[model samples]
Structure formats: structure tokens, C-alpha cells
Target chain A: MMVPATSAAPQSGAHDKVPLLELEHLQMLFPARAAAFGGKRGHVHAVDDVSLALAEGETLGLVGESGCGKTTLARCAVRLLAPTAGKVRFRGADITSLGPRAMRPYRKHMQIVFQDPQGSLNPRKRVRQIIGAALELSAGGSGDDRLRMLLDQVGLNPEHANRFPHEFSGGQRQRIGVARALAVDPQLIVLDEPVSALDVSIQAQVVNLLDDLQDEFGLSYIFVAHDLSVVRHVSDRIAVMYLGKVVELSPAEELYRRPVHPYTLGLLGSIPIPDPVVSRSRPRQLPRGELPSPIDPPAGCRFHTRCPGATDICREVEPPLTLYPGGHEAACHHPLNVSSSDIAGAVRSPAASRSSGSVVPVPPGG
Target chain B: MTLRDTGTGHVPVNESAVGVLDVPAEPYAAGAATYRLALRRLRHNHRAIVFGSLFVLVVVLCLLAPVYARYIAHTGPNVQHITEVLDINGKSVDVVSLTGVPVGPTWHSRFFLGADADGRDLAVRLLYGGRTSLAIGVMATAITIVLATVLGLVAGYYGKWTDGVISRVFDIVWAYPALLLAIALGVSLATGGISIGPVQINSGSILIPTLVIGIVYVPYVARPIRGEVLALREREFVESARALGFSNFRIMASEILPNLTSTLIVFVPLQLAHSIILEAALSFLGAGVQPPAASWGTLLASGAPLFNVAPYLTLAPATMLVITCLGINVFGDGLREALDPRATVRTGY
Candidate 1:
């Protein structure tokens, strides 16, 4: 019921500057044969019209359920997966259709961190070899000092380089993955749920390490994850996706406080509050049905079937993201309009109500 | 075991003598420490060990054929004429020297096998034949492995035009009957139609069969290797290597090649067996190793006519061939199973 915080608009002068990485109407479809009792051959909408932008030194959080196309979008952003349609511009140059040979130079500037730390690393290669592989590929640095510096940058001992991946802990392996990405001194890193496979305690350490490294290198990150809390912590701007489509996007504080899109609200509601009393006091709005199959998604809004305020209009036509008074945007026919006072009144627990001031609501339309 | 360290957190330390990291090493746990593990696995596979040992013994014998032939049959001393040494009374003397003339009534020796119908020691002939067989197998297999590795890696890694061209070429080669090509080449060699530089070597010699076998089997070796390359080329590590800016060649050679070691190790022995059997088959058909040189196949061929009278001739060479091939195959199977990721770890007794 809490009103979300409004995101401050960027100064008019700064609006003219180009984004470091930009994807316009990106779509990636995977062709799959129809089921045995099925109608027609269909394509899995792995990524559907996902458009996002990352400015210099910005971390854009892309959160979604599994099969929601976050990873696919991340890959497309880095040109690992070619977009079925739309443009991917980096530094004002369109690189969406760049050939393999042409994309080679751009690879040095952009890199990706895979989700599964174990699967991401080459089991046959030693830690040193894995790290050195990137360095050797990009011709990053010469001599032992730079190599040692790369290792040290990731908080790993340079001496431990000789060990194979099997010899490293999950956290350490992920660090090696990060080290490999950073080998070429890349400007942007598409971190595809880098810490999801690690232990809960280890996740914090990795996140902190990434934060430290980002600060040190002044690097922009396209952080993809399903964990909203983690996304909130790491991201400057957050994009909530469902069924291969972005439902909402806003600054971290504003998105959490005023999640106008029903899917985003459901996502926020699903996060377990540490305080039992506050969690119990808040009204839970769990969506009834499972996600629709991407092969043939719903007629209009992909989330309409699960949207609390879904109507005929939602089913008939997909709503494009409409900018609110703040810089926050949400693609919802019927958006939430909870007031700060209402949120304060609704809270049963004094402890919960005390923290309600920090929650600011984003307006429905610009 | 703590949950943190049990499933995913266990890190293997590289304890190489030289602390140089990134150097490729076998995945077996280091030192005599894990000897127990390998020993246990090997022990459970009794047939494998027995067969592997036998194969090793055969290879060792083939390598030392010159020494054995010299000492056992006195063949090295007189390659032209092998006469059974006689005493003053004109009766054949039983030379006690391991390298002395063959004096036994039958072609049989303790382990040297036997002599041929022409008074040539069968044991010596077998050893000499082994020398030829092993040389051809090793040389031909090396060529196959090298050619297949390069072509397969290039085709699989690069895909598109390179893959298309290599695949089509292999398909064309494969569609042509292998045995027919071998026979055609063998016939060409027989007619002195094919010449290498100044050498006017006869087609019936070992060289012809070796060349025929090598050329025909190149596709066989390349196909399997290509399949492996195709699967591995798309692996995430390969992508990661590319992301790191690794040149295509380095990725193929250093990153990919090491992974295919177990496959190569398993295939080499099988290839050797195949070459040997094929050579013997060709010789039996009168298209392989000519007389005087004395291949097991030629010996077998000679013995076939005398089988009703002296079955020992055919039985002797055939048995040697069967044992050698069986041993090689068993060892190769053992190696394949050992390299298998699904193989259960046995605690050696």
C-alpha cells in the first residue's frame, strides 16, 4: 500500500548524451517443433521486444522468472545471441548485424559473466590457465605483474593461479570468471546471475566484490537475476520482465516503492520480508496461474492472465510503457494508486509503519 | 562433510613440481596418493588388465624384434640363407644359444612360435612380420590422428564454408567403397602405375598396403574426430575462450585438443588393430606383403595349402594374430572405460 519514491528526472543537458549500450526493440526467437497433438510449428519467444539502455558507470538490473528472457537479452546485448530483430547500438554505433570478424574488436570492450560458476569454467583448465586464457586472447597485458594484478583485482591470490577450476571453491571460481571478464579491461559487463549458483552467504561476498570492482574500474553492468532483493541492492535502474517482456522500469528506489505494473507488484510481494510481523501485516497478492508458454504467448499483454487488474483492454491490446510524473515507467492498463497515508493505515505493526516513510510511490502516467 | 565444501566448493590444488599454472595435466588425482583409486578400478576390470598386459608385452616384443630374431633364430647373421647348424656326424646340432640356428623338429620354440616350410624360423618370421605390422600401424595411425585432428578442429570450430567443404569432401570419400579403393590402389601398385619420385617400388610390397590402408582410413578417423569436435566446439568454455580474445588456433590446439586426449588414447590402439587385421586380410587375398619378407598373413596363406598335412602352419600364425588383436582390443576397451566420466571410482584392495 506504500507509495513508491519518485525518480528525479535527468537534467535536460545530460539527456542529449548517448547511452554506453542500447538495445531498441530487441527480439530473439527459438524455433521449436509443435507438440505431438499440436497445431503448428512455433518459436519460443526467448526475448520479445526487450529494449534497455545503460549509461556510463550505470548498473541496470534485469529481473525475471526463469524462461523470462533475461539471460537471452543479456546475451543479445553482448552480441553472443544475435537478435532476431531490432538494433543494438554501443557508443552510438549500430553493432546488431556485425559479422563475427567485425564483432571481434567489440568483444574486448564488452564481456559477459555466466550464471552457473561451475558450468561457466572449463573443468579441464587450471585457474591460472582459465584467467590467462582471456589475457592471451585479447593480448591484454605483458609480463607477470599485469597477470598478478588481474588476479589481485578479483581478491584472489596471484599464487593460486596454477590450480585448476576443480581446485577452487564456487565463490573463488566465480571470482575467476570475473577476472577473466576484466582481463581486457572491458567497459561493460553483462553479468548473467553471477552469484545465483553460489551459497546464500557466498552471494553477498560476490556481490560486494563486484561492487568494489565496479567502483575501481568505473565499469557499467547489465546485471540479470531473478532475485529482486539482490537486484535492488546492485542496480541503479531496475527492469522487471515477465514472459520475455519488460513490464516496468525505474530507478531502484522508485521501482520498489511504486511498482505500477501488476507483475512487478506480484514480484515485489513474493520477496519474503525479514520481519515476520511486517510480512504478516502486508496483504499478499500471489498471482493465480503459471506463466503462459512463450511458444505462443497470450494475445495481448503477456502478463494479462496473471494481472490482478486485468480487463478486456489488457487482453485486446498490449500497453506500451507510459512515463509517470517521475522518470518511472510501467506498461499496465490499470496501475496501482496507493497513497502514503493509506499504506500507513494499512500496516498493523508499529515497526512496519515506522519504515513506511521511506516508501515513495511513482505516479501512473507522465 | 560440511554442505559448503561437499558439492561445489571443493577446490583441487595443482601440486605440479613446477608452480607454473595453466599447464595441462591428466585429471587423475596427483601422486602415489591416488594410485590406490586407479589400482582399484583396474583390479575390478580383470579382463582389461590381463589383456592390457598382453598387449604391452606384444608391443615390447615387436620393438625388440631385431634382438629376438638375431638371438633366437640366427636370422640377422644370414638374412639370405637360414641353415640349421649341423654337427661333425652330419646330424643337426641343438644349439643351446638363444640366438643360434633353429634345430627343433617342428616349427615351435618355447615362446618364439615356429619356423616356416622353407626352413625359415617361424618365430623369427613372426617377429619380423610384427616389426612390419607395428611400424605400419603406428605410422599410419599417426598420420590419421594428425590429419583428422587438424581437419576436424578446423571444420567444427569454424563451421560455415570450412565445415561444409570438409564435410562434403569426407562424405564423398566415405561414399566410395573403402575396400575397393584399397584394392584399386593395390592393383595400381602391382602394375607399377603409381610411382613416388625416383623409386619404382613394386605394388605387392608392404609400402603399397600401408599407403592403401592409410588413405582409405583417413576418413574413418576424421569422421569420429569431427563428431567430437562438433560437440565440444559449442561448449561454453569455447565461447568463454573466444570472449577472452583467444585466437582460433590456440583455442583449438590448447583448449580443445587436451580434452580429446582420452578419445585419441582409446582410438589409437583400435586403429592399430584394424590396420593389422586389414593387412593380414589383404595378404591372405594375395594382394599384400609378398613372400621372403614373411608376414603373418603370408605365412597363414602358405600354411592354408598345407593345413591337411601340417595344420600347425595355419593354426600357428592365425592364433598369433587372434591373440595380438584380442590383447590390443581389450587394452583399448579398458582405456576407453577408464576415461569414461561415468566410470565408478573403485577403492583398490
Candidate 2:
């Protein structure tokens, strides 16, 4: 808990400039009732002690398996679900505690596109009403002209604006979702597994549209997905979360080239190679066992149960995220694909350096 | 799979167009197109049309009760003509026989559908009774819907102490069987009537039965609406609305309420049918529509004892009640089928 207060300032140093959005020590815990009578009460630590920053015009990909709190973190960033504890600074203003009315002006600056295209749209409302409602709420320009222009911009026919959402294809509906987010002209848009629900063929189309839209509008994005292959194409920087904690935050190219975290290595290796010979030849690095219950997570490193490289130190004390060259970060006592000298220099926390004697080769920075 | 080249994370603009509708696009026809589509679908349902028309016919005839009484029967619903003689087919007959039995159907302008033991015109009474029954049914339904919708929306949307208080009230009401509750309320209110603020309703007023029947069935309707609202509030669109900075009230009215429209519409006729039956049950037990004024239930009560002597007296009102209830139910089913189009056409890639 005390780690965030001391380490938050240095964490923002990765961005090298004033961030467009910063989430400091964000935590979200859902109170869960006991399954049986007179049982002890507990909280599901969905997101715990996560700090991140997004510079202007940057896309940060959040990659993790299901229930790793990627979606929760994204929602918290947009203020959709207020974090139980944290400071969310958007454009240098603290917005975590702002009421809906107080947050209205800031709403136009950030928007989110949901995962489900069908469920995200009102089925009864016409296409015109669906997008127009957002336009109306923002108090933007003339409704019809702007609506027509939005339809065109998203690559949908303007003439089909009167049709219902159910009448459109899955890809088309997703485009409408993107168009809705863009209607307010937001600077930072959180794409929460936007293309996951789409077909493989249609996924590329929507992803391409999103990519084009970002460059066209000079917008920043937090692209969240479970597939590393999908996130690698659009993300400048990728953050890998494991059991409510970020195990790795690295530059996209550097992460693929040399993944330091065991969880990140497992995720990258899980992506299939098309060539059968190469696919079979490569060692399967998929993590072992199902995800442990979030209500009572593992005591030390949450990934120690699944990590093959787990040692006595990994089982006793959780590793702090150590920064390597070019802003690459990974939290692991025995980091893969890194020199012992690099680990000695990268280890920032004294507690981690003391517990893991392997990195005692070099003197501490302090 | 063509991975867009450029380790710099280039934003791709795929020229593969998603425009151009496969289905022929119609000219913009706005303004409650959903309702229009429902109406079009309803028109194709023969059962709804037939039964719906039957209900309408009953209502129209009930509304013309005075016309039938004055222009045809020449006797009011409560008028007694026991000693009077009527000519039927050129033969003179007493309205009530010498032994105190009422005359049967004269098939003439007077004594139509025969007379009750009191020598009152049963036909005139039947129509007037229908008017009263329909009125109570409609008014009670209106009361139930308005109260239940407001309560359900509030309780479901704001789930805390507000939900606790309102839901407990619903449970208390729900614990009692609807008929028993209505009877209990009806018996108490029918004696002294209701007086609140500047408004007063008489003991024998139809409004008494209406009010009793309305309050009793609120939990039945409200429980469903509240349950639906709970599920609806969690939907992604609702979250999207909140993300857009919509107020709680705005989200409830525009976002949640419109989705609930079909559910509410389907509930209307089913509730109407339920309310009418309950009203009839209450009136039969003598806790409804006092003397002189006639309802189907009261008529049933008055005619049941005279079933052997004048069976038509009982049969006439009973048949009307059955038909009305059946018609509304059948029509409600059709409306549900008509409105249920939530499944959209999935376009194959």
C-alpha cells in the first residue's frame, strides 16, 4: 500500500513529459457476500495498486487473460466506474471524485468504446437516435448534418441512418460504436476489447478503421485485448496484467524482442504460428492452472503459482517493477532474457534487492 | 492475415468498405416506426383482431344502454312494472304472474329478455351493469399501472433504503392472496367511503371498488417491472449513458424506460383482465357497487338464487363477463407476439 505513494512520481518518468491522463494507485474492490450463512465477508480485489500514465497521441495496449482487471482499469480511467481508491488526473485535473454534473465538461475529453457491439447499442432506438443522443448530450452542432457526417466518417451509409441497430451487421454496429465515441471529439478513447466480439475477417476491418481514425483525429487510445497479436499491431506501449497487477510494461517492439516477465513470455508464446512444423517445434509456454479466486488472492506474487521460474524469494516477497533501458519494465526476481548486470542496475526497490540476492552484483543507486 | 507493416505502430486505413446496405433501404419514415411495425404485425393476427373487435362491440353496446332503454324497452333498469299488463302477440299478460313469478321474454319492445323477480327489465340492467364493470376495470388498471411503474422504477434504480422500504411494502402486499386482500380492503372502505384532503367518494361509488382492486394488485405488476429494471440497469448501454455524463433521471427515462415499453404494453391487458375479474369477485361479495347501481358481479349475486326460475337473468351478465375477459386476454397474447422482434437478422461474413 505504501509503495504507490513513494513510487508514483518515478513511474510517470517513463512517459518523459506531462501525461494527458494519469491513474495513481487506483484500486477497485467489490464487496462479495459469503456463500454460506455466518461465513466471513470478503472483497474481490479486481484492480489493486495499478499506476499508469498516457501521453498525448499514444496508444497503450492492456493485455491479459479474462478477469485480469483490464476492463476494470479501462472503465476506471474513463470514470465509468469510480475507483474505490485512487487519483485519476485528466488534463492535470483530479476527476476521480467529481460528481456527474461536475464531470460533464471533462466528459468531452475522454470517451470509451465497449466490447459488445450489439449489447452496447439500444436495440429499439434507430441509428439516428443512437448516435444523435450522444451528439445531443454534448450540445454539439446541428444534429442531422453532424449525424450524416459521422455516418460517412465511420464508413456506414448515411441513408441507412433511420434503420435500427439490429438491422446492421456486427462490424457495422461496431463502427457505429466508434462513431458515437468520436461524436464528442474526444482526445483519449478507451477501446475496451472493441474487436474481440467481431469475426476474424471483420476484426481487421474495424481495427483498421480505429487505427485510421486515431491518426486522422490525432487521438490517444487505451486499446485493451487478451490477444497479444491483436494488441501488438496498434499499441505503442503494452502493459501485461496478471491477477490484478501489471507484471510488465514495455515498448511494443522491445516486449516482443525480449520479454522480461514470465507472464509476458507465456502470453507471447501462446500466440500460434501458422506453419505447423514451426508451431510444433516451439516450446509451449502457456501458464499452468486456472486463475485463482480474486477474493483471496495469493499472498506473495500472484503469478508465483503459475510461473515455472518461481523461487523461494518469489514465493516470499512480491517483486517490484524494475525499469530497464528504453522504458521497458517487468516485475520478477528471475527475469528472463536479461543480463545479471542489467537486473542489478534495474532493481529500484531495496526490499526486492535484499530478498533476491542474485541482483546484489552491483551497488544500489541510492 | 496481412499484418500491417511498420514497427512504428502505423494506423491502417482499410479501404474495404462496410457501407451499402444489402437490403433495399427505404426513404426515411420516422415517428414511432416501432409502434407502426407492431401495429402491422398485429393486423396479421386473426385471433387478436377477432377477439379485440368482440371486446369493442361489448363496450359500444354498453355505452348505448340509455338508447336501448328509452327508444326500445321504454323501462329503466330499476323500474318495476309488477302489476302492469303487457300485450304480447295480441294477448294480455301480467309483467309478473299472479303467483309472484316474473314473466319470461316477451320478444316485444317491452319486457325484452324477460323480467327479474322484481319485474325489472333484465336486458336494460345487463347493459348498464356492463358499463359499470368496464369502467371499474379500466380505472383500476390505470391506477395499478401508474403507481406500480413509478414505484418499481424508483425502487429498482435506487437500490438502497428506498428499495428496502418500497420492496418490503410490495412483499407485505404480495404475501396476501390478491382476492383476499381486495375483499378485505373492499369490505372496510365500502362502508365509510374515502375522504382525503378536499376530495370525497361515497360508500356506494364505483370508485371504491376501483381503488380497492387497484391497490391490491400493485405488487404483482411492480415486482416484474422492478426485476426488469434491475437487469436493465446493468446493461452496457446504461453504462455508456452514464459515461456520457447523463443524469440518473435522464438515464432512467430515456434509456431504461423505452426498453421497458414492450414489457409495460404487454402487461396492460393482462392486468386489465386480472383487475376486472377481481372487481367482479369483490362486487359479488356485497363489498362493491351498492344497491340501485348494477355491476356484473352484483347481477350475478342477484340472479344466482333465481337460477331455476329465471336462468337467463343469471346467464346474460355471466356470458358478457366471460367474453370480455377472454377477448382481452387473447388480444394481449397477440400484442406480445407482435411486439417481440428483439432478434435481428445476422449478416454472414
Q: Which candidate is the best by DockQ?
A: 2
* lDDT digits (tens) for residues A180-285 of candidate 1: 8998889999999998887675666677678767877888888999968887777788888888877787788788887777888788889878799999999878
Q: Is the docking of candidate 2 incorrect, acceptable, medium or high quality?
A: acceptable
DockQ (C-alpha) of model 2? 0.40
- Relative to the true structure, candidate 1 has a C-alpha RMSD (angstroms) of 8.6
Range of the 10 consecutive residues with the lowest summed lDDT in candidate 1 chain A: A347-356
Report the lDDT tens digits of candidate 2 across residue range B118-203. 88888899899999999999999999998898889989998889999999999999999998888888888999999998899988
- Full-model lDDT for every candidate: 0.71, 0.82
Candidate whose lDDT is highest: 2
| Model 1 regions more than 4 Å off | A1-14, A34-41, A137-140, A273-281, A338-366, B1-50, B68-72, B76-115, B158-202, B215-227, B346-349
- Give per-residue CA lDDT, model 1, range B1-349, as digits (tens): 1113234463222111122123343344422223344456666788998987887787787778778766755665125333444352455444323343333333333224444445566666776777777676677677767777788888888888999999899888788787666666666675574576897666556777777777677788877888888888877777777665567888898778877766777778888888888777777776677666667777788778757655666776787788889998987787666655456444222
Q: In candidate 2 chain B, what residue range of length 10 has the lowest lDDT sum?
A: B340-349
TM-score of each: 0.81, 0.90
Docking quality (DockQ) for each candidate: 0.19, 0.40
